[model samples]
Target: MRLFHFSEECSIERFVPRVKANRTNMPPVVWAIDEEHEFTFFFPRKCPRIVYTRSEGLTEADNHLFFGLTSCNIVITVETGWYDRIKKVSIYRYELPAESFQLFDETAGYYISTETITPLSVQTLTNPLDLLMARDIEVRFTSNLHPLREAILQSSLTDFGIHQFNQASAQ
Candidate 1:
């Protein structure tokens, strides 16, 4: 199982365990993504996005509503404002050793380690939007992600991640 950590910073020699904003009550831990859901981080950090897949239990109606005519199994939606940034910014994909990490969220493909560690290797992704296109992942840009967020929250699309909601546009 390959584990990865994505960041905008190029030279991160060491990864220290730090408490995430949402995980404040828990102990500090280093987070990494498994191979399956690595696409979720294929953008600038905090670039509000809604990444989802058509999982087994997804209802046809809900799938039609959310996915529409897209043939891609996965869809990543962000706002128009982040388009330039997505096209220009470089993301560093750090390959981390998985020996010390344990699964944190299976669905989200997140693994957590309580100890600090060094990356096995690092690769820079120059064009994030292009990577999505190359992988046959549909990228949707809108004026705001609120509507999509509301729909997914009430829909049967349980296999989804709405990241950095507060960072999304109001309108």
Candidate 2:
């Protein structure tokens, strides 16, 4: 599967082959990113998606990889919303960093990073109703939460509902 890695220089469109043998079979697609790791872009696929996680080191799972190699614990969801008008929305950008050395057996001796929750509002297409028929308006921000996911999950129910919908559709 193809995954996007956001960086300052460029947004890497890496085509991680389903199999290790096909790694060298295809070239990757790279897009330029601004100084800030932020940009308004769309994947070639539908919204409410999960990209493969990033990892370092070796493991039986990593060694015997397939097209859908799960590594990082991150999931990004994109959905459409409506308020005064339709809004193209994306949210729930969560990153679960490796918590224990066992997670990355090869890098066990080194210090592992804690999970980070990055709440991102990638882009909002205004007046999206003209483009699509959907209407909803919900926004809130709160503190007292250690991670951003808690804040996000508490702020809006619409987003959470949409996330569930996406997951159901995928299955």
lDDT of 2 by residue, 107-131 (tens): 1111222222222222233332232
Q: What residue pairs clash in candidate 1, if any at all? A: none
Q: 1-171, model 1: which lDDT tens digit per residue?
A: 999999999999989999999878989999999988898999889899999988887898998998899899899999999999999999999999999999999999999999999999999989888888898999999998999888898888879998998899886
- At residue 41, candidate 2 shows an lDDT of 23
- Judge candidate 2 against the unseen true structure and give its global Cα lDDT, from 0 to 1: 0.25
- TM-score list, all predictions: 0.97, 0.19
Location of the lowest summed lDDT over 10 successive residues in candidate 1: 125-134
lDDT against the true structure, each candidate:
0.92, 0.25
Question: What is the total number of backbone clashes in candidate 2?
Answer: 6
